[model samples]
Target: MQEIKERFKELRKELKLNQSEFGKRLAVSKDVISNIEIGRVQPKTLLIDAICDTFKVNKDWLVNGSGNMFNDSKENVELEELLYKISKENSSLYPTVLKLSQLDSESLVLIDSLLDKILKK
Candidate 1:
């Protein structure tokens, strides 16, 4: 079994969250996240449950590294669900959504900046 602290750090990194952001989601201070990541403190069951519930993390993976990180089927289906919903309710928006999904990361950033400017106007 992996050490819980190391697993926690891995989970946070995989989620692309910095300590402060991760801690905010867990209702803990950044210092608490730092301590947990560095093995200075062992998380109690409450915190463990919070992590699993809040992020849809697989408890087995977080605790024992035994399974996929995200256990919830909803996580896996999010994009598909979004596309389906948009196609069903907003046919005009569905093509745009598909185009956005296919954008490269750099192009996506440029699009985001353009969208921000347009939204601010």
Candidate 2:
């Protein structure tokens, strides 16, 4: 079986975020990340959202440590799931939507147009 902590350490290095920075984003201390990475603690399922959110990690990749780090998507299904999970984990996303809401009517309209374009893929 692939060890999650090892996978996490590998991916973290790939993202170029030091443990302190990554833990800060995940709302945990660097020691927490270090503990997990060093096999001092095993992460739980609830941490999944936080982990994925902070790292922009592929959940399937983290959970199973299998397949491409990137998953192939068809029908926008994967993207929709990714967005929903990310939005759920990050409360700031609501503020992001609100910030986008501040855009003028034409800009907001263009944003919607862009989303429609993506969804149509």
Candidate 3:
């Protein structure tokens, strides 16, 4: 419980978001976030799911602090961080990156195959 509160604060910091901003991203109020962080309130499952989806946070780590913070492979995390940096440096790429992120695994594999063929040519 205390660990969850502490990790909640840590996750918000890792995302570079203030409580208000983090709450806005989660469609929650700042007070709600603050309460959860202070262990005055427990987050609901829906909020937890939203947190995981919006920030690519790991459910297990967020719930129990049992694993890596991000819900991604190491390589994927590196790539995501790179893309995040790029989006910050070049805002124009943000939309493209967002669209790319919405692709399913099969679509990603197809894109990867196409890119590999192009690179090999």
Give the winner by lDDT: 1 or 2: 1
**Candidate 3 wrong stretches, greater than 4 Å:** 73-121
* Model 2 local distance difference test score: 0.74
Alpha-carbon runs more than 4 Å astray in model 2: 70-121
lDDT of 1: 0.84
Residue 10 displacement (Å), model 1: 0.8
Location of the lowest summed lDDT over 10 successive residues in candidate 2: 69-78
- Count of backbone collisions within predicted model 2: 0
Alpha-carbon shift of residue 98 in model 3 (angstroms): 6.9
* True lDDT of residue 43, candidate 2: 82
Model 1 TM-score relative to the real fold? 0.60
Best model per TM-score: 3
TM-score of 3: 0.63
Question: Which one wins by lDDT: 2 or 3?
Answer: 3
**What clash pairs does model 1 have?**
none
Which residue pairs clash in candidate 2?
A: none
Candidate number of the best lDDT: 3
The number of clashing residue pairs in each candidate reads 0, 0, 0
* Model 1 poorest 10 in a row by lDDT: 74-83
Tens-digit lDDT track of model 1 for 67-106 = 7878777455355445655787889997798799899999
